[model samples]
Target: MSAPPFIHLRLHSEYSVTEGIVRLQDAVARAVSYRMPALALTDLSNLFGLVKFYSYARNNGIKPLLGSDVTIANEADPDRPYRLVLLCRSLQGYRQLCDLLSRAYLAPRVRGRAEITRRMLREVGVDGLIALSGAGAGDIGEALLQGNRVQAASRARFWEALFAGAFYLEVQRYGQAQQELLVSETAALAAEMDLPLVATHPVQFLERGDFKAHEARVCIAEGYMLGDPRRPRPYTEEQYFKSGEEMAELFADLPAALENSVEIARRCNLQITLGKSYLPDFPTPAGVTLADFLRQEARVGLERRLQQLFPDEPARARQRAPYDERLQLETDTIIQMGFPGYFLIVADFINWAKRNGCPVGPGRGSGAGSVVAYALGITDLDPLRYALLFERFLNPERVSMPDFDIDFCQDNRWRVIEYVRQKYGAAAVSQIVTFGTMSSRAVLRDVGRVLDLPYNFCDQISKLIPVEANRPLSLAKAIAAEPQLKARIDEEEEVRELFDLAARLEDLTRNVGMHAGGVLIAPGKLTDFCPVYSADGGGSVVSQFDKDDVEKIGLVKFDFLGLRNLT
Candidate 1:
């Protein structure tokens, strides 16, 4: 297909956490339907949705431009920082972008927001990146709005010098106050500096009607009523996904700006390697390969376990034959799959936990079916006695990464994590980050509160929704299951509006969190594989990507879950 006249250079997916409502699948499908040849996902400061976005775009024959809408520290007033959109033009730019983002999160945050400084940007170097002045939120635009053309000009010069020929003055026409002024000033500055102009629509939702739902979502996050005069309204309904023709018409006066969006898409070509495992290298004894060391350790461990099971010599001999066969079969499959190091790494940590006086639970999950795990003491269950098939754990027919859910005494789980961090460099180890989404019942309560409804009334309506095992049923299912909920929706106009808005906002991310047990150990620096961020309230360093995305980018995840009963 021929390239569309204009492409989106700035977009925020649902992975933008609470601020965006565009799902990656929906975004890519829309792009394909519009016949756009390429699209960019510049989620706010995080690359959490990048791998999935890239995969979806590629599978749909759309080029994926990887970028981030990052906040740079404004030295004059640290609390109010400036934003810039950085797009990767090559693999090296991707790596640099990851490093910069990791450092931003690692540094001391201002008011709980991660930011990088001008010096940090230069130190990291922008070798293969395209910079877009963040339009109204950018430093230049902010300065111009304040009637300080000198500061805006100075900021523009610095960025132009830093990004060289790759910097573009971004312009947007969203129906916001002073937007026309910013646009005219930006165009003039671009002309004065001889910089290219690029048009972008800061997409937060998929359609125009999603604006109110997005507003309700923001109110829920900020603890404010939707109608409260004090509440901030930074977003507009016009920020939905627009076709290339709409964008071209929006910037018709300066056609070059629209053309530059497609030009930037052509420049950014980031190819991600997926579906491969990158395991941390386990140190083996001198003159012994990883496979040999694993075999030696498993054999010795099995002999010790066998003695505990069978004291009589004749009984031991009779029981040993099948155990030996199972161990050899499992070991060969593990080695063939190039996962000896993975098993060895898991065994080392579990053994360390045991030796350090921390109570460890016998293995859980499909990994409990492995004879090798039993031999290595990674699991206490005897697969042979239970007649568990090793194939259930690691099937030679269907190759996949083996995951063992290890439980430790809740109080001592952090000790195991620290031990792993020391054994593997700290830069190589990080906790996985998880996103808390708005559930059906919670969304209903939130929408009601934001709408200034009576507290007891909202609570009454919410309680009618069915819950199973402490998890609230989906609104559709709950409404079907409960006649009271259906009656309220059908009888009350306010109730119906609340339900309709809640349905649209439900399942979108509401907050960030750390996964209880999932931790990643990369082969080298974790930043080399993916960016890392400090969790909320200044907690441990966490991977920006969650559990599934980490594996998709080739990082192996190990679970070190804590169980109070194990204590």
Candidate 2:
């Protein structure tokens, strides 16, 4: 039988943050191009690309190995740090890895340095996990480079004991002289210790030609002059993904290294399954179901609101026949739609906000069209009085989430979030994460900085391109818009080069930040349902999913958007 295809145990994508330039989709495409069966994404320190990687790989008929390049404390001296690459071989292993990574960042420690401890690994590391000694800067490589072969071997022995045959000595050759020597030494040590040696390229780019652009990115990140020969740069262009024949040729002297890669792929059998929402159980008062309680409260509240609005009306005149019928219909609709708890949850905090003197707006969007919301105090506007249709707010004919775009005083919005956190357990509530992409203008600026182009020349060229807020300007569009730009591209090689690199990098997510008022609340612990990230100030947990993806994963997003006008 033909041997299983080689698996790339160590690969990085654009999610690696300036270090790697291959987008996740392009990476999968490249792997498929080579007819590779599976690949692993060990992006630096975070599984930011995990879900996307998994979905793309699976859809493209390639298996995705879920892993992360985590910084771990040095064994001999817990102060020094080095990265260790861990891959999940089973569902439990994936969960264990998530827990380890979560604790590594969430626990109190030094500001910038986040490292997982040996104690954490022992406690949380599950069975069916494959451990790889990371590339040149990894723990074992650092030890070996320091000429401490015994220490490196000792660490290997410890990992072998912890993970048994699941631990492999990961050796990478990126054409660096040091990496060449380290790989040879590591392979020898693995053989001596009866451990397998796996070969990897430490892939950061998809093609050799991408090296220059990737290097420019590195310079931008390190705040260094690209032309300066003194700046530390990546060892070589050999860091791009290579074919199986290329890997075989590179490790021809030690065939087992290439063979071990296939073996590792055969051994790893894990897949990350997207989970359902874990919405918290909305507490019901004594002798009343959540649905019943919501209806009772909304009805009583609506009557009081009508009385306050028309206090001078006689009782006979106040007995409007339609008011009670509308209330009953809205209440029945809300309960039947399985959203009584959702409405109550939204109303509770809104009420709390107003009571505490926090300014709340009348309403915005179709949510203002709900009479029940006006009754429950979820909104200040009267739908009946304003001639707003309830169907527009809660379309029974077309089922959709009841969205209330609440506007709160910007200054006191956090008070509302704090109240929600207090009412629901802290683990149940969190902000949604959003990413910022490098747009056409921004990418032009980045490339110009790296190419060392004159500031005014770059600014003038950028200004020539017409600005479109929603639609970014393409190189072709820019050429069409400005005759001078086309002339510069045709005449100057450097100008062309800047545009070429910028075009490639544009629209790539450059950084991540929290969404302003999009909070997701679950019925159970969020970590059980989805991954959570601690906010910058360590104040709140943020879901890794964006607004739309959060809904796809079954968590409804309630946008308690803060508006300055509310103040």
Model 1 CA deviation exceeding 4 Å by range: 1-3, 468-470
After best superposition, candidate 2 residue 421: deviation in angstroms? 2.2
Q: Per-residue lDDT of 125-199 in model 2, one digit per residue for the tens? A: 657578887756677787788889898888788888888778878887777768677987887788788888888
Range of the 10 consecutive residues with the lowest summed lDDT in candidate 2:
271-280
Count clashes in each candidate, considering only residues at least 3 apart in sequence or on different chains.
Answer: 0, 5
For every candidate structure, what is the RMSD over all alpha carbons to the true structure, in angstroms? 1.8, 2.9
Give lDDT tens digits, candidate 1, residues 19-44.
88888999999999899999999999
How do the predictions measure up, each by TM-score?
0.96, 0.90
Estimate the overall C-alpha local distance difference test score of candidate 1. Answer: 0.90
- The deviation in Å at residue 472 for candidate 1 is 2.5
